[model samples]
Target: MDDGVRNTREWSPPPPASPSLVVRSPRQTVSRLRTRRTHRDWDPSLGRPSFAARDHGPKPSEVYGFVGSITTVIATAVYLAWAYTPEPCLRSLGITYVPSKYWALAVPSFVIVAVALSMVIYIGLNFLATPPPTSFSTMFDENSRERMAFSPAMEEERPIEPILDIGVVQINNLMFGDT
Candidate 1:
């Protein structure tokens, strides 16, 4: 009978997580200690803060970004002046510590080339590291999980499968097969 077949199928509830499996950390202990220390002056049973702190000024990152952008803009202006301004004008202005004018043209071009080369190298590395078309990993790997099976009738109502990794052969058959 169908019931006999169902009974024969292996069925067991997942085991409960053991105490040994639970992970404890010094960070959690330190956090608890800090909380207890902060609440020592007042009983926390009422659930109210002792004092509210006011908003601090701009964060360190915001300050850094503002300074960095200003510095870059100033440096760019100086570089442009040094590179494009005539040598007589620079001499007349009593500014002579600037480096060779040739560097201004070369440095930006070199940076552009380096960025483009880095992009190409990154794409090449990705292509080299990717699994081939015939590799079994295309179907399943250590991280691959099986899709939960459902009744054939239920398939019609469900619009999407849980997993999205459709096989090349399946796609090819779907798109180009005989009706």
Candidate 2:
């Protein structure tokens, strides 16, 4: 006797005349919704001016000279006090001065002279090495205005180019003859 149940191998559902619903996966539905929302908000013509393009006025580096000068003066004063102060105070703190047999008197004097020389060198270097100060008006001059106007929208967005080591690269290429 044949069982009333249909064979397990064969199964089919009747097709609808019109598609009832396009069964999208949950991820696809969410992505499609986000895309639609983004497109709706986007305006092709009305691009916002970039930070570089905007006339934000004087750069911080222009005022850095004034601050640097003040700091350098203070630093020099502190260095002079530290270097030239008496060794007696240090000796009172139980720091013994074991002078060498050959140059007992000369060692301490030499150290003091060296320290003074170093301080002078440091101060001189700082004074001589500094960039010339830009005036407040010149800092915000026409050149800066032109720079701000012509600067690209994605100036900050560009990836930093790694500093090229041509010598190293050439040496490696010569040794390896291209892998």
Candidate 3:
């Protein structure tokens, strides 16, 4: 009747976090000291809602994105107005301080060509760095490992085998063998 197993496991609080476990910068340390940090350090505390859990308007990232989107839209509108409108129309509007119209085509064209050339250069670098097919790297070099043999009876209890590369002969035999 006395088999040693409990119906429910006892709950234990997690071990205290060591200061040495985390490396913090002096600025971050000062910032942390300056702010009153609040965390739900217990399971039960999470069940109740708090100030941090409430919706606090738009996040900083969302605000930044909104501003960036508006700025981009305004810049594009200005660029289009500058590029398509005739010189006489711009001067009539008292906006004669705009850059040469040639830049509208040249800048975008240069950016496109730069991006394409960078991609080509990256591919060429990779091709140059790759080992030849006939190189010793194709076959596992002197660092190749053999899988340790285990008794058939010990298969269930055996530890996980170390990683070993399958040889070309073994691959061919597995694929093309009559057996």
- The most accurate candidate by TM-score is 3
Q: What is residue 134's positional error in candidate 3, in angstroms?
A: 0.8
Q: Please report the TM-score between candidate 1 and the true structure.
A: 0.52
How do the predictions measure up, each by TM-score?
0.52, 0.21, 0.62
| Residue ranges of candidate 3 with Cα displaced over 4 Å | 1-55, 141-143, 149-159
Error of 1 at 157 (Å): 22
Ordered from best to worst TM-score, the candidate numbers read: 3, 1, 2
Instruction: Itemize residue pairs with steric clashes in candidate 3.
Output: none
Steric clashes per prediction: 0, 0, 0
* Model 3, C-alpha of 10: deviation from truth (Å): 27
lDDT of each: 0.73, 0.58, 0.78
* lDDT per residue (tens digit) for residues 6-114 in model 2: 1123324447557676576999878966765321222334465435444687778877987899999998785554455556764776756633344545666899999
Question: Residue-wise lDDT of candidate 3 within 1-179, one digit each (tens)?
Answer: 22232122344544647846666699987996677444432334336444554557989999999999999999999999989999999999997788999999999999999999999999999989988998988687777876677899997898888878787777789999944
Higher-ranked by TM-score: 1 or 2 = 1
- Using lDDT as the measure, the top candidate is 3
* Native-to-model Cα distance after best TM-score fit, residue 116 in candidate 2, in Å: 0.7
Model 1 misplacement above 4 A:
1-55, 143-179
